[model samples]
Target: MYKKETRGMDIHTFATDGNQEGVLAELEKGIFVDSRNEKGYTPLACAAKSPHASVDLLRLLIDAGANIHAKVGESQRQPLALAACSGSLEKVQVLLDAGADINAESPSGYTALLHIMFRLHDNEMLLPMAEFLVQHGAVMDCESQYRESPLSAAYLRRRWDVVRFLLDAGADPSPLRWSKLLEAVALGSCHDVKELLRVPGALQQRDRFSRTPWLLAAFVGHLDKARLIHAAGIDVNEIGQCGETALMTSASIGNPEMIKWLIGVKVDLELADEFGQTALTQAVQFGHADCVEILLAAGADPSITNEYGDKPITLTTSEEVVRVLVEAGEDIGDVSTEMRRILIGLEGSSTLRVSKSEYQEGCQRRFGSSNPETMDVPFWQEMIRTGIPAYESKSQFGDLYEMTCVWCFNRFGASFTALPDGRYVQIGGEHEDYYDPDFCIYNDVVVFQGDGNFTIYGYPQEVFPPTDFHSATLVGSDIYIIGGLGYHGSRRFGTTPVYRLNCHTWHMEPVTSTGACPGWIYKHKATLSEAGNITIRGGTIAIAQDGVEDHVENNEVFQLDLTCMTWTRFAAEP
Candidate 1:
């Protein structure tokens, strides 16, 4: 064992000392040239990394059975990687010539060429060593564990020449190429855009959100890039997946400067999105007072109702917005009195107080009991039959009380359904992974009512869609949910189901069953503006991947316009 250790150290010392003669002579003395020291370093690795060692020493070590492929560190520390990171061009060549794996990776997944490009910042030999690694089959665009490419790293390091070299070798920078024009505009990096556009097929680039280069540029107020894109002849008013023109997008986010720029260029101001909301209405909905003022100055009509018959003024309660609309010849009389009262609470009014939740009630509620459709489990059905008390000890809201389980009403979108027989019912709501012992994690379609305080009827039906922040609006004794965010049948989305509950009879059923609602959303403002219009305004579109919440950017304003009690989705707000 002592002989083996001594042989390893002797060869390592000779290799690192640039003693080519000693390295050869040690082999003649039967010292194992490739033996590793305590640091796991072979003699060839030490020689390759030694700044004082000549190429001849490295060659002698390789010729004397030194391991070219032997790695030293827990990570990559192979002979070629060591030579490459040191920018030792001659040693790198020698190791490659002796059949080292050019693409050999460290334990952390860095390739040899990657080590060279990553470490030698501010060194004049960076480009040359980089070129050498690529010539010897080192992947120029090799990715690390974080999926960072060589081009991305070089760009981040401001190594312009290295970035250009990597591009020249066909290193496709998917991250940059994906958003070259947009990012250039956003960062005001006009000087680098030319090289970015030089990337093969750059002109045809679109972002992951499918926004064209010019749209992003204009949205960020970059007129120079906008002009460049406009010169390319793409439509400035072209609509995106969100159904927004650059003008509307700028208007939506309240970029008055961008809006003015777009207006100066004579883009269409009257172009409404698929939702029938003009740029003026979008600005109003988002409370962009500046955008609204600007659009109104640009001759945007305030009285122009969206598809929902709601004027721009109806989307906002802002005094500034109201002033703008009134100045633009809009009448305040167009808003319903109920809406006005709701906006400003009914303080000391003569209107008789309805049920605490606003559902109409009466003495004799409708028909016989519904034999609930078979869906819920028998155990839950038995529990429902027993009922939970509305007032475990005492009632909080009114004299009337109902014996009902909290399970039916403890959901996200669930609300009090007013019954004609002086009672109320709860249909559905939403919940996630909650650990409460008393309440079930999810709500069922079991019936409950405030009829003495409201009795909890056990699970009567298995609801198809779930309720997560679904909106509820009451018109007389009929309670309606506009749309909800959850699974429909099996697929989850921002689904619009015309769910109607007769507080009179306590019977709930699908009314329209055909209105193709927008994507799922929750916490949006939905209101029955008048007789038949249910306006659903700005909300987060509910999107989930593997049951984890996904980002929602849809500020969609849609409405369900009812005709003879049936509903149709309208691209309007009223």
Candidate 2:
């Protein structure tokens, strides 16, 4: 060992063990470190192998002027790249600070960040190494032999913070030829993803799959985030790679809230996807009753058949949905043979224009076209009068006031003949304006009576108006009012109290637990399955902490079995 040491450090042990300090010292002392080890690794190879060798050691040998870019025996890894791959951020920093090439190419043509990003799992060290390399003029767009850039690697690993840092340090996220912003949003769902979407030039870019952020969010059921993206004006209905619209994607995922919100914004529910299935078909096929209802209400065509020749009604399991479709089919009266002949005649005629002489005569006779754009006040009043009946039929005020009280009475599934005051009498399901009970009659009406003074059979019942949206659900024979806003005098009440209604007797039960029964949630949707399980979906909990108000979609589906008197989470199969 001593004799070989005198001949400088031999390759035999240095190649196997990578103990380069002794060999490095001997090289600084004018002794040549041999490359003929058992595996033919030189001192440089050994130094690169450990990668934790101090900068002083590297510098001492480099001053003796060892090649800074020397490749290892077989792997051909340079010392700087090896240091990066080993995740020795300190050693990497030292070597780069000592004028080691930041842009040096390895045998595989990987930059330092490329090696670090691909090999090291530590983001803390990798981030600094990445920053240091980019700060010292490292090429951010350098594509690996695998056609991956540093930005792509960061995106694949879902390191949005690292991606942000890289982008800030002049990394071109464009050569990725994909929306790293969408990938970040899809994977991380980070709030900082908003920054990437707002990155000025990012919205116009599409991914390799040709999907925008809005399409990706919709596909992934990130409804709230998708809404934010849509409000940013990136074309909510833009068809993606397979001509799949956001509406189709939302429907496929059974996201009723997203469907309703999209419909509320007037998204074309009739638009078909690549598979030629409309949003309504997708919703029905997936058995999303709520989504089906919303789509139907939004005027989705029930008659349009898919490639399978099945309409939306064929996919429903509920009798109520079948009845709705049957009623709708009836409303579309048949076309007459004479009407068809008249339509065909109009279509085939081309010289049907009224002459200018006829128009002048008609205008003079009608006392119109004087200013061309203006009409007589009485004439305009007639037009307004014509619209009043239609407006009243559809308006909320008309529905509440002028519409026959029978319609309102039927809304609560109540049976009554007539009152002495010439008003329709209701059997039950009535509440005052200030305090209303959450009650539904049969399959017809779900009524929420608000708090106010109400005379029930000429007797006043003390009222409590439901404070929040999720205060009630009528499941089977029971009206389950979970949590709501309570008012005591002028003070506001916020509590989660589970109430049950057996026929007409109202019983209150206090839910004394945490997590399962959270306090005072509004805007919740509750469903009662045929198995008698009550499933509550999303809602907003009314509470603030640390000066911050919090709202949640309440992804947990809870089931309260009346027989067990226990609340168990409903774990549905995805």
Candidate 1 colliding pairs, count: 18
Q: At residue 484, what lDDT does model 2 achieve?
A: 42
Backbone clash count, each prediction separately:
18, 18
lDDT of each: 0.62, 0.53
Tens digit per residue, CA lDDT, model 2, 1-574: 1122335544334423444565555555766644434444456545554644554555555566566666654555667887777666665666776677888876667877777777764456777777777777888888878778888787555465677787778787675465667766566565756777778876666775576787767766777677668777876678977687889878877888888788877788888876668987787666676777778778888777777665665555443444455445511111121222221221222121334343222211122221111223331122122222212222422232322211111121122211222222112322122322312111111111212111222111122232323334455444565654333232122345565532233322334433345445544545556787566566666565675555555566666665664666645521
Q: Best-fitting candidate, measured by lDDT?
A: 1
Q: Please give the lDDT score at residue 368 for candidate 2.
A: 21
Model 1 TM-score is: 0.34
> What is candidate 1's lDDT per residue for 1-574, written digit by digit as tens?
2123544477777777888887788788887777776667777888888887899888777767777777685564689989987888998888888999999887777888777667886688889988988887888767888776677666555566887788779987675545655567545466766556555655556664456777666555566677666665667778765677888877776788878888988888888987889889888877788898899898987877888878887777565665566567554334332323232232222222234332212111122234233233332322233332222211323434432223322234454332345343444554323333232223234443322222333223343344555666666777776555554344356455566655545455666544545566665666666566776676677566797767475555665666645334555543
**Minimal lDDT window, size 10, model 2:** 330-339
The TM-score of candidate 2 is 0.33
